[model samples]
Target chain A: MNPAFENITSLRAKLAARDITPTEVIEALRARCTQVEPSVSAFNHLDWDTALREAATADASLPLGGVPIAIKDVIAVKGQPCTCSSKILKGHTAVYDAGVIERLRSLGAVPVGRCNMDEFAMGSSTENSADGPTRNPWDTSRIPGGSSGGSAACVAAHEAIASLGSDTGGSIRQPAALCGCVGLKPTYGRVSRYGLVAFASSLDQIGPFTKTVRDAATLLGAISGRDPRDCTSLDQPVPDYTASLEQGVKGLRIGVPKEYFIEGMDKDVEQTTRQALDQLAKLGAELVDISLPHTNYALSSYYIIAPAEASANLARFDGVRYGARVPDGKDVLDVYSRTRALGFGNEVKRRIILGTYVLSSGYYDAYYLRAQKVRTLIRKDFEEAWKKCDIIATPTTPTPAFKLGEKTGDPIQMYLSDVFTIAVNMAGLCGLSLPCGFVQRDSTDLPLGLQFIGKAFDEATLLRASHAYEQSTEWHTRRPVL
Target chain B: MNVEYVAKLARIDLSAQEIETYQNQLGSVLEHMDAIASLNLDGIEPTAHASPVFNVLRKDEIKPSLPVEDALSNAPKKANDLILMPKIVE
Candidate 1:
């Protein structure tokens, strides 16, 4: 195996056998970081000295000891600048570690640095990133999809063994799909959201971006379970995600939602996904065609509801609190106005205004309330479909990533990219995206992601299906020729 | 809504460039949202949060506070461990 291409499982075994020291692994990672990071733009922050120190102290017996992991900038890691890649939050340092960060540290997983992302996790492509765009490691001109673009890129480029990423709509999984990595978004409350900066509070959940499905689960096993600080977190027992990986899908029922194969989907993506389904059928899992009829309005309903919630949640970022504060002028309003005016990016401002408009007096019931009702109908559609199958599978993204500046000028076109994934969030379900295949498009090299969504709190089913798919294919093993 | 109507209602004086962009973007976005407006959601209880969380019970205990200096340490301009802001009022 190439020294730079070790997955979390292989890295753990090497650490146990003393074939690689924590210091050497960090050196290899730092070396890889130096080589590919400039073109990749995978990180917003780097602190090698701190990572080395932590790695040096990793317990010799822990499962993930000494594996360097990257954290999305939206997440807090005590004493680091958790900017969420926005100029407004520039120079703001966190006073505390996020819950997931603490858990990774407790397991001897060294947090290498903060990865880049869309400002406030607002955009689909990291092009909206204030830190500048995170390019596809496979093709520097194309996008590494956002809001967890940096995390996916870093994991894909082998900068870190795995990384932490937040998904509100398709943020984590979308980027993972584009970058050819595995990303999982747990059920709404499966992972703690206490320390995560809220984008759309109701839709946001944090999970992993890894090179393999099992690693995504292993990393999840470490950070999941109930936390007293976040009341919204499900108070359910945490299961060993890796232990259930071998639970064969011999008798599993997989539903391929026909609605996802809508018109205008890229021909290559459609063909590749169809090929994957045939393989799954040969693996003994029955494939059934299903429908998500309310899907047509999913994007419309989610846009209103997510932005409305985001508008309310982000209200706490005023200068009175710990975020970037504008210089105080005569009154409080001046401080707030100037701070927000200078701090927020155009996309964030756009969403905030859109959210504010939809939630205003006369528009409240007409826009926000109706979107809520549609959200229910969308969820009900899923509940009805689940009774016929064990899991739903589709292409994680409708198209392979476009050029960085391709859709930046059009926000609606950008929102359309989340079409296949956002409804899953609106329905409060769990989903995982893994690299099922790759395609050559637009003379640029980027991978299309195959997304498998499980019923609410049915992460095991998604993982089992994805693992079975991966175990039988070599797509997960391909690497960028950096 | 007219450009000025929204600008005043939102409490921000948007630049001419911003107004042009908003006029186009907001108009289209809202038009797309029109689909939901026509849905008959009669007698539907609006769902607030996707997850379940009950009345939170917290121990009403106080702990030592971060020194005033530490709390205000990141403030760009401060006085006596307090965050300093620009003067208020128009």
Candidate 2:
């Protein structure tokens, strides 16, 4: 068996036992990347030379020793291109390592591939990537989900042992769900955002995409903690996540929000989610009915606030300082106008326009301010639910992965893909998505994710419950046939 | 949806066709934003951040800066020790 196919825990054990050197493991990973590239196209830029050089001397005692991590392109890695899968940053090499990258290196992980993503993390489907879309491993005809599509696909297809992804309105968890892997979004401020390119500053967070729940915990522990570079990073001491993995979910109150079971959700997805809930109840978890009345308004509020922030964040790429530039004339205004128009993709342009409209003078109070007010209500909804339950459970997404061109023409349908997952980001809380069940669709079995939302800086409970649930289920064991 | 004006403010030039298409597209998004407009927001405080960490002031001290070579590595246009841009004044 290729060492690359092993999860981090198993691989680490083998490396420690002197059964395989890091070179052999990385070589196997490179082979897998070559084998899977034709079908998955998971990476925007892959550097095996740097990976091998780093891995050759990795300290085996470190937590992630000799592991190859596929990083979402939005995160900076010094001397490597950080394109964010857009033409705007075509030749822009990162000037320094992001906080996560520094942590990953300190723990002996080799940051190998630049995973593809929706341009500037704007779209739910990775079809927005200028390089091309990353197809789902379960069914190539379908999308892997995004804008962390490449991050999830790399882990799913075994191109990398694990990956790092940023979640801003479901970018990490949603794609991890669609790809049948474990993805965790730490509580806002639980992880530093200094190196992550801003999508929506208030909502964006860095997290992990791993093959196993334990690997998720390990990776999260390695990359998380306070970084002085990011002021929003929580100063709380990092918990030993691996210590609580075996803690059972008995006597735990699992809240099932009625709002997540919307009318348009797929029938099979609904059935599988309910069955998983039943299994949890059978495992001694007390299922409680809960109401988050402001759930429906979350999407409306998110679209406004995220775009408004994105507009301000993305304005730094005006053909000056760095990034791709189009010299139109001697006039600086002409340069800014033409460069941005030529550099950005359609979706990005549309969002900039939307953001500008909301923040404009006449519409500021009506749209931006109103959305912020609605955001307060949405956070309160989660706060109210917390009073009754230890953890809130929901289907990670409304349905399994859809066909490549399924909802591309209509942006609203695309936006609806993140309905269930966006609110967690709005409230700046942590959430986890792990495989709980599988639904056979179009002659292929697609994975369904179960999400557990936890309180602020309360990843311990989320990891505990998800670990228990994962141990009881065989869904994570099923791998897609290439 | 005045896409032309919005694009101008965003520093992007849009074609006539793009303007027309964005008008319809952004119009629908605006319609969705209108949903929040109808809600009663009388006593609610706007939540720009969900965390309780406020006014995070740090010591005003100098830190290690990026090397000059690293800082200018990705510049599209560079002269000796400085970034070059199009002429701004006549």
Candidate 3:
């Protein structure tokens, strides 16, 4: 049987029934990756030998037994090449597994490869990747949304059964939306970030990109819970996320924020999102009109706080430590300057400089400090909305995937791609983006996603609502002809 | 915007042309950031951490760490088990 496009639940059942061995699944996936990697450019490090070897001995009793999940290069898997798709980390191999990797292993999930991403998870398009862009499987000329582009693409193209991705301001969800898959960014602190190469520490959370909402829930259940290594990891019990997958969203209040449907939103996105909401309403959900008043400030505030934190987090990548280094320097300072200049891409350098300037002595109050305060206001906006609604709904992106180089030259236009999704991260709420409809352009069907934001630790409700919508609609089943 | 000074602080070297380009780009970014000032945030506290859990303390017991081989494995320049760096204060 072709393992491609099958969800983990079905794969596990097949493994248990002895219809498919773990080695057969790994071999089939490896063959699929070989077929698609040239066009999709999905992986940086594909360890087929180790994956097949591990699959041979995998225990079927474990939850994710023998299932191969592609990992975002930003998240470390021990002994694998963890490049984050940057020249700086050219030959760097992770010495230890990320907290999520450890959890995946305990559940018997085999990591098949390190998927490409935006350099240091910085940019909306995978065009920022030093390893080259991951093309959208739906249309090879268009980009797979990023920084988790490879993670989303591999899942959409069926190179891997599921994939893990990091979302710092819509990295996972945006890519999933563009690639036509299910992506969930858990509540901040819901997943441990101990081994994730730090991008913007507070906003970055690791999540899964999967074929179905049930697979997303299953993967989230396995990879979540507290880890002592990550200080921000919530000290709470991990729920069985799949337990409520069948519970339809009856008596659920889904907020339709007027601010999200703004003047410049794409007509197709608006129409499709409205249609999805109507479908949800038909599924017994009450669509309440609500307003997240501080929504406009999210993008601006995110640009400030994320860069300020990134500047601090990225300071460790000097010439002295791990990864690539420049030897042509007279002094230590020269080495640092030369190495960083040669190492980082233009976008990363721009962000680092912007971050430094904002956190500088004179501009602290005007930019960084004030931006943090605006962050508070944004959170409060969501807090107020929760009183009247159980879930918040919006278009996952303002539009579907654009051409490869469409927004490359304009930073602001690229930043606007995440306008609908960034507020959830700033408010530290859990969000899920699932395919709802396809917008046909030039005879090519590009997928549009519907996003749902839920209260802290209320991912179960998100799963139930999205699962209901997913089951009711046929959008998730429409695979891109790769 | 003093792009050179910020680049110096970031320890990244930039050409004169790049500096001029950054000045214009970052100036606009700062202009975008100016939107935050319009909010009447008098007594609002900044959110440093999204989760309430903080100042977590763990047991003082020693735990096994990555071995010397693994620790120095990724170093660009290394001698046996130690990472090598350029001369300083000489």
Candidate 4:
């Protein structure tokens, strides 16, 4: 059979039938990595020898046995450095595997390497990576969306079968949408954050970025269970996500938020997102035009809340506790100053300062407290809308991947990248961005993604609607040329 | 809005060029934030977090942490296996 470079289920079935071996899969992945590494810069660390050794031990009974998976550098992989793509953590290695990593191992996934990301998961593009930018495989000059940029790029370009990514504020979905893949952000506590380096603790959740919804589903099924070690983990049971894949969205109510169709949204992106709705309607799903008025305030609320939380979570990284240090200092304060100065990137330092400023005593109520007040409005916006429909749909991003460094110099332009996504995070809803179509921007083809968000703990319906759309569309089947 | 304020907050010193640049960048971003500010949310309550359980988390409970050796092993400067650093008062 000509190699079908698609979903994990078919790949696993082939492996079970002895049509493909773990070694062959690993070898092909490794060869592809070597060929694409220079162009894509996907991985920060790759252990090919160890990967081959582990893949050689494959047992067919394991669900994902022999699949080569990419790990986002921000998540802990026992004994590997969870650097969060920063210089401060250059030599630090994780003492234990994250809960998600443990789940991946239980399903027999081979850890291929650590993919690059935005430094401290701060930027919308991988260009802010302390190590280097991970170039978009679709068009080298354009960026692969970030901070899960490396995982998205690697999976989209076939560097790996699937990869794990963390989404704080659109980190997973934005990149997946930009790169033509499926990315899911399970409910805030649906997946454990114990191994994920804290970006915005309350907002950060670990999820998968994959080429197909099935692969994404398989990975989510493995990692969705609660971990006692993580306090915020949901106490609910993990459902077999794949079991619902065949349950088509015949009666699902999919809502299209009218607020998302705002000015400055790329016309092609809007058209494709609408086309996805038409596809859903054809599949017997009902489309309702819903209003989420509070959506306008989501970004403001997120900036205050996320930064305030980040400031507190990151205070642990003093010169004394974890990460980088200053060799020379007159006192503890000096050490703290120098360490923070030397360790964090400009963007990180900006966030920390902004975070601290908002949380500071004098300005607390005006900024942080007030933002918190607006946050409730944002969630209620969804609550009212969800009462009328099961899932809400929007274009994942305002536009497809833009050229590298095009928006890097402008922080607002970069923050605008998450304009469509930040609200979902604020409302504490579950969302997924699945590739819906490709748009020709200039001379290059950039993949456009459609986002579906569900009420808290309503991921099953979101998946059903998304899966049905995927069944009818050929967008997710396309791959970037190596 | 001054360079010195940002420098002190970030714990870094910047040249005139960097200060001038950040002012412009931050200025525009903050201006764009006006859109989010102008949102009229009179009767609606703001949602700060997603979780339903409130104040139910247990008191600080100590659990197994990495051994001192393992924790400090990655430090660049150490004394008697302790992480040594530049010293000062807060």
What DockQ, on C-alphas, does every prediction get?
Answer: 0.49, 0.84, 0.85, 0.48
Q: What is candidate 4's local distance difference test score?
A: 0.81
Candidate 3: clashing residue pairs, number: 0
- lDDT top scorer: 3
Ranking by DockQ: 3, 2, 1, 4
Task: Write one digit per residue (lDDT tens) for candidate 3, span A1-482.
Answer: 58876789899999888888889998888788888889999888898889988898888778888899999999888888998899999989999999999999998989889999999999988999999999999999999999999999999999999999999999999999999999999999999998999999889999999999999999999999999999899888888888888889888999999999988679999999999999998999999999988999999999998999999988999978798899778888988898999999989999999999889998998888888888899988888999999999999999889999999877888998999889888888999999999998778999989999999999999999999999998988888887
Query: Clashing residue pairs, candidate 3?
Result: none
Model 1 chain A scores worst on lDDT over the 10 consecutive residues at A321-330
Supply candidate 2's per-residue lDDT for A192: 88
Q: Isolated chain A: TM-score per model?
A: 0.98, 0.99, 0.99, 0.97
Write candidate 4's Cα lDDT for A252-277 as tens digits.
88888888998777899889988888
- What Cα-based lDDT does every candidate model obtain? 0.85, 0.90, 0.91, 0.81
Predicted structure with the largest DockQ when compared to the true one: 3
Model 2: interface root-mean-square deviation in Å? 1.0
Q: Which prediction has more favorable TM-score, 1 or 3?
A: 3
**A199-301 per-residue lDDT for model 2 (tens digits):** 8989999999999989998998998899989989988889899899888889999999999987867898888889889989988899999999999899999
Could you list the CA RMSD of all candidates, in the order they appear? 1.9, 1.0, 0.9, 2.3
Model 2, position A291, has a per-residue lDDT of 97
TM-score (chain A only) of candidate 4: 0.97
